[model samples]
Target: MRGLLFSSSKASSPSNSSTQSPARTPVSTPHHRTFSASIQEEDLLYAEQVIRRWDLDSPFYTKLDSLFTGDRREARQFVKSVKNLQSAMHFFVSESASSEKLIHAQKLMQVAIKRLEKEFYQILSANRDVLDSESVSNRSSRARSSVSNSDSDEDDRISTWGTSVSDGERATVSEMVMADLKSIADCMISSGYGKECARVYKILRKSIVDETIYNLGVKKYSLNQINKMDWETIEPKIKTWLHAEKIAVKSLFSGERILCDYVFSSSEKIRESCFSEICKERAVTLFEFPELVAKSKKSMERMFRSLDMYTAILEHWPEIEMIFSFKSTTAVCKQAVASYVKLGDAVRAMLTGFESTMQKETLKTPVHGGGIHPLTRYVMNYLVFLSGYSEAVSDILADGPLQVHSPLPESYFSSMTSDDSSSISGRFAWLVLVLLCKIDAGAELYKDVAQSHLFLVNNLNYVVSKVRNSKLRLLIGEDWVAKHEQKVKQYCWGKLSFKFNEAYRKHSTWIISDRKLRDEIKISLSRKISPAYRTLYERYRGYFQGVDSVVRYAPDDLGNYLSDLFHDAGASGSTHSSSSSRYLSRGR
Candidate 1:
């Protein structure tokens, strides 16, 4: 019914290439000029049948539906027609460039490329659901595995298992769409229509990549825009970029690369060119958002988010490099590295600034009762949280080691340096030392030497407790905790007995005001200082004169008096006089 694709004597069947893949374009061979000169008629006759569909005056020209999309069976026919047409053109080039049939075939070739160009665009646009990034990525991964494990026939085997939604031979819909694209890309590139195919692919796929990143909340903000925004405005955007970067590197760019590779699998140069163009600009911009955020106002609070962004890129760099491996897409990898470095610099600057601020703090005012100081709370709280990011912080701080320029005791610095001053443990240990020193300075504000020691004990205990409870303990170690704990006990013995006596002397006339606070203080002092006070008291009992028998206030009684002193009603001396008389009578 149809003209033969080649003479039965010399030419092979065009359908032979048909089984290869839908991506196969019609290829031409060099034959004897005499063969093409004689057999050119068979080639033109077969090709003219396909040309008629686009032929202005031919009866078949009015077939309004595209030759490629109307009938699924026709997709193969379209590729075969282009191949047959190439045979005629080969005759013209090898035997006679001026052959009249060559002009007709050239026109037919243009029609074919034009037709394929339209179809390529259509399939890509219409199949957005089937070709979604995740699905396509999944297919690409499977296809890659199959090709690696099997012979070249894997392409043929998988294509047969087509992505078609229908059952039986109809499974070609899902994968068929990709195959259809490959076919169009092949036919176009082989016929020197590569520029047109690549241009169309680049524009449409580029937009999709751009739109996906946009939907993911990534944007190309100028430094002025980001720098002008406050942390509140910029913070949410950083979070969005953090989330989006993962999908972009893992699935978005990855899927796009996979899709591009499959569609143009036939031509390495064209595929790389197309894939690179599709992902480069948008991907580079997507990664650069973190850099912009890092360049914004550097502060202690924003540092962690910047590090989060940095850590994300650092973690995903391998995939980014793999997906954008093409030379054209190298910018994407470089931009991500740039973001990683810039965010790191921002993080270091913020941490150093925090330390410098801590160093500059002069403890001018003392906290009353030697309780926890704000400086102690603020610095310890910040360090406790900073220690939570041990891995990231350690990595960052490794680049810039801790520089201890403070007036710290040489022995302490020697101890840390002997261990590893630049290590995270030493780094945090140094921060703690700086905090304890500031707290020590604050202790001087207390008039009583005993209260000064108590101030140091309370604040250092808070610092140690914070370390013990959080990841700081692992970073700073138990030796640091035990050493400071011993320091707390030492302060508990410091003229603490004087505090008990002073409490009774200052407010002896007053009755206890807050019984709850009183018991709490009693329990704290008893747990810490009682046993030692009792030992000292029993040893020194014979030292007091005749009043030894009348000594109404025992070491056990001191806890009750000190607990009540802070929470007292302003009662007269008569109340204390009666209580002392009762104490004396009870003792006797």
Candidate 2:
């Protein structure tokens, strides 16, 4: 009786029984179609209800399957069909069907699952091709779009896309591809297709990681963060993305590649920004520097502070290069050079204005009290201080390791001194020379040529002495001091030869004439010309006797009258006792 019932059930369900016989077949044939058509529509509906109950009872399978396959719109339909067929087979056999019938239905359902798995593989293969073509199209379109823009705007538009599928859409497609592959692999493994499952798993794993890198690591994160990057702020985000816990677990190599490209591209943008800011600051500071220098001590200090701040930016170059792996260190150094050049120009202009002001002041009134003029002292002090820091200035100017050569061996005042013309030191030396020339021209403004020469001697002596005593000596060199000292002596000789000796020759005979008349001439000469004449005669007469002028006075008489030249108590023609004089008492 049981055998008859089983045979009758099999006859009624020809599609299920026929397909069950083909489960062991290596290749699908017409029986596979008969198996698909064997399940009654009513039984399939009941199976769907049963599958829904299983979904509720074992939520893990549903959730896991959803996680692995949710990206594909068709994947859910395929999974639903598989679950419905499985449910219908279980439902039909349990409803009073014989044990053989039950076994046949299970076999038929297993064949359907294998067929569905095969179809899933084909779906994944098709999706991969579509995604590949789409990614290639996206890259090519982006390249074309970037090329269409100007070079200046190209960097800004480097990642812009013209496609209807935006970055987010591409990400979605990638996710779909990865999820579909994963679902197919998981289905193959559960169905005992070990070899096929391993092959699919490999592809699925790679796809997941590659997709994550392209979608999350590269496209999504970098596009959002790159434009806002700066020297101080860019590294953290890059590190976070590269070392992300999720990314590290899934695709460390892809993360590294993404990091490299992101850093390289972002750093290029940052470099341009840094250079632009540096140039802008340079131009603005240079425009305002002359006025700042002329205002007060505070203004000069502010200018120095400004330059220091600007120069400090160069110090970050190493860190930037390290982070970004910049191709050329020279690019960073050039920015520093440009900044230093502008700063040097501002310093030169300020000094030039200062020299002009000093010249006008010197012409208005003679500097007195045997001291250097205030303006000259200030200029020399500042320049001396500046020269002392030549090494630091050179570093700032060159933006790299720099050797500050000692002052030229030749005279600083020489027309042709060998200097590293490309260096900051050379520029500084030229500025100093120009200032000295201005000082030389300023000396001519004094009303008395002898006084003018005296003024030059005083200032030049002060400069030479200051330079010799300080670090400025290293920059101006020993020869510079000696040359200026010799200049001082030459001016002193001029004062004596042209102003004093000449006056003495013209007045000496008058000094020895009738005592009353000689006395009157001597009094007039003392007020107008005698002090300078006396100063030169007392100190330099012996040296100049044969060379500068003939001996104009007998030694004893000249000495006696020199002592009386500045006397105020005696009348203009009165003869004074010679013994009262200091020079006359010591006469040879």
Candidate 3:
């Protein structure tokens, strides 16, 4: 495009308007007509040598096939001769418009371009291994020979990659061959045959790109087909896409961008158009896979996979933005963002559904011994697993509305900063609270008030333990754990005192309960009481002041007294009642 606009066809003429014409007539009306008349006076001396080398009957075409299979050193000379022909065409085009030399130059320009086209295809096909994007991009700046005037400002013709031979013989033969391709491409483009060069380039490069991606295991699928597939079937495809997306961005698309820019450096439009054409569909294929997966059936099991796809694209977003930055190829980027945003919405939707499911839990049976409930364990552990992708989860939650119901302890909501509502901590905390509230509503399943309170303790303790020990600790902070834990201890003390008073009052005069049964009850009660008793004694030691007997029993003494609890029917109940009353009154 930069060089004097030569004809697109082999037989270009001033009258042929088929080619894109320059703003100025290539054969400018000379300010001095005699200046043009003088053009024929001198350059004709080397016209024979200049045009004959590429006279269409030259030996180059017959031997072009041999470069792939045999001695290929002449390939460099072939490119040089083409460049020389381009220079001569520019030379004669600048001379008298009607000069016979200019006409001969046009004919030779066609012949030279024809031979160069054959060489271009042959070099590209033959050097397929040698001209890989990695090789081309890495070694390109070293091939510095220019195909046009150094000072040409057309298209800013300002480029780092040039179209000539490598700097020296030490250059790898592959680099030399790449140089040959660049040289041929530049000459063809400058000679107004860039369309022919680009046609062959796009077909071959697109195939290689498509093949590389397919070999990486990415298959093109219609959106309808993807939508019709079940998760069990499409899940693996999502995983395959996860792997393929990284490679395609880092190696496939980026490499093509570099290679296309390098090969067509002489013309920005050709390179932009070519690169866009070559990579747009392939990139759209990669990005569209995620969008399709996002649109497919979603469930709790598929949530993480969706996040995996979201994160896979999110992590590589900048590269995708840059690689497909061309206006013609922007759909690839748009598709990527669509998939990204859709996956995020899917995750939040799944999270909302997961929360709703907890609220709808079917398991209402109270654990007979006040141990952790099934809903508490399942939902808490689910949160622990979800916390591993904290960064992604945070981004997903960043836009989420606060889902915390007001009945949740205000401490849970107040501890959050303004931004924390959309952070992983807020989302995960909301989830845990949803489970906790569900448990609170189910407490009435137990007939005994003490057992119901104890059930709350068990489930809250389980939630606290999970958050304290796992990645959830980092997400939901220590303040949350400590607050919930204090509630656990408070419930525990109330449950213990209530049970002890009930047992003592119901059986004051009773005796001779089975020894084994007595021992099991004592052991169970011991588990609750001894540690709390010891802790209280240590914490409030001497608080009873001078009345030491009001505290009467140490933790060990209490355990010893428990052994005599079901003895002889006639044993004095008054003494036991007296001490228990004194202790309970003071403790209360």
Candidate 4:
């Protein structure tokens, strides 16, 4: 059963005029009015009662428990169900919250948002479908049609589906969605669910379409028609669709592994319907669909890790390359970590327990055939160690001291030493060392061995050499490298010099545009907490500061001197390498 929301008032009251005549009797003074208003509380218990009653026997509630249940398959089924229910729940709660019942409106919003995030656990679960379906679905619709249609489609049908809209049309749609989301967000904030509104709004802003017109590359688009569009009508449908999308995705993570597997076994159908036909433009970005497919795969794997089901996911890993790609899902992860931190030490402690159970010796075992093997055991272990103490991974890692691996048995490097083996030891060692340095800020902890310094220098050199070679090889290996090159390569230690150079050029603009963020970057860079991290921090900060300082502090002639500063930062590599090269340099 559903509940009815409060209706708007139709009647209007007389307005007060600045010049008051003696028609009205004298009332309480301003001081008395303030005192009375101070004690007021907006109650929503009645609305809450309605929400509770309507959602009591709802399948979403049942799915919620099942999604969290130990049975992975059941859990995923429940997640899917709950996701579908999320939109309905959001609307029901939001619509039902009377304006007068402010606190209750806020409470319902919080509840709905919590439910929205119920799929995080399932995101990492090892279902095969998670990885497989994404790539398979993204293929031509003819190839993907079995789940939705016959492979032999007529030419007219193809023409109808693939209507060629120019980039301008897509931009307009993106703008429409973005505008609608912003309006809904404003409404939510006004209604007392500011926090939830921000969360939902941020996700929509990032995942669907970036709201920044400059970033969206819609340079020529006109905002003149903004008033012409029916923002009111578009806003409600967009909100409804967004709620539906979140709920549907969340519900997919529920149910038993087998149940989710069976349900989404028809990935082709879902993708063809939701993606191929609807959001064809987005299908080009592998990161988007891959994550969703991975979620599906994870749902199934949560229940059937031992079965052949995970094989499909394993095979699809390359197609969904962000795991190793430079796309850097770090920002998303940072948000998650930040959210957890806000929950306090008790919640942090519980996460530690959960982490241990998820990785407790069993999931690490390798499968015989291809499957979703955990690639992050060491990282996860490190996270667990830190989680126990209630600390952020970045805080502990970013620009921290390097930690030494306890002496490994000689066998650890034996495979890599073999003729056929790739020398992955150095790369893995570099990764661990980088993480440690960032996590701990390396401090004065490993000053004796100078491991942090040496590690940075060597990796920086290696990455630089690679980038240079890649630039040279661009002609010959251009095709291969174009497909595989990581965007992060530019920020890697070797490229810090270049990044700094780039930042220095733009330093002044940032200061004028966003001064505070510039200051934070400067602090992070100047602190010497992390040499490698400093490159980015400094670039961001320096450009911000450099620009502002040049404008405010430097005269036109001195501007060249500031430009020289940018040049110096970019060229510091020679001096830096000369000093640090002694630690690990192989004698010429």
C-alpha TM-score for every candidate: 0.72, 0.34, 0.72, 0.16
Worst 10 residues of 3 by lDDT: 153-162
| Candidate 2 residue pairs in clash (backbone atoms < 3 Å) | none
lDDT of each: 0.70, 0.45, 0.69, 0.30
Q: Candidate 3's residue-wise lDDT over 1-588, tens digit each?
A: 334543333335545655655765356556655664455433443444544554457665355333223443344444455555556555555445566866766665676677678767876776666566555545544543433334222223222222333435223655556555666677688667899999999999989988888987887788789878877898888878888888788777877887777678788899899998888887887788777777777789988888889888889999899888888998988999998998988888888888778767865577877678877888887888888778887787776654655444556745678666555676787778778778887687888887788788778777888898899887778788777766665565545555765766576446655667766876887888789788866653442233233344557656654654665555453355555556555554
Q: 28-140, model 4: which lDDT tens digit per residue?
A: 78797555434322123333443443243456465434222243333233222333333333343433344544444445544533443332222212222321222222332
Tens digit per residue, CA lDDT, model 2, 100-132:
545654554455444445544554454543344
Worst lDDT 10-window in candidate 1: 1-10
Q: Per-residue lDDT tens digits of candidate 1, residues 257-301? A: 888887777678888988887778888789888888888789887
Q: For model 4, give the 10-residue run with minimal summed lDDT.
A: 153-162
Supply every candidate's count of residue pairs whose N, Cα or C atoms clash at under 3 angstroms: 6, 0, 0, 52
Q: Name the runs in model 1 displaced over 4 angstroms.
A: 1-40, 50-73, 145-174, 406-419, 448-454, 489-588
Is candidate 2 or 3 superior in TM-score? 3
Q: Residue 146 of candidate 4: its Cα lDDT? A: 24
Clashing pairs in 1: 163-174, 163-175, 164-171, 164-172, 164-173, 164-174
Mark the regions of model 2 whose C-alpha exceeds 4 Å error after superposition.
1-301, 307-371, 395-422, 511-588
Candidate 3 regions exceeding 4 Å error are: 1-78, 94-104, 130-178, 220-223, 368-371, 396-408, 417-424, 448-454, 489-494, 497-558, 566-588
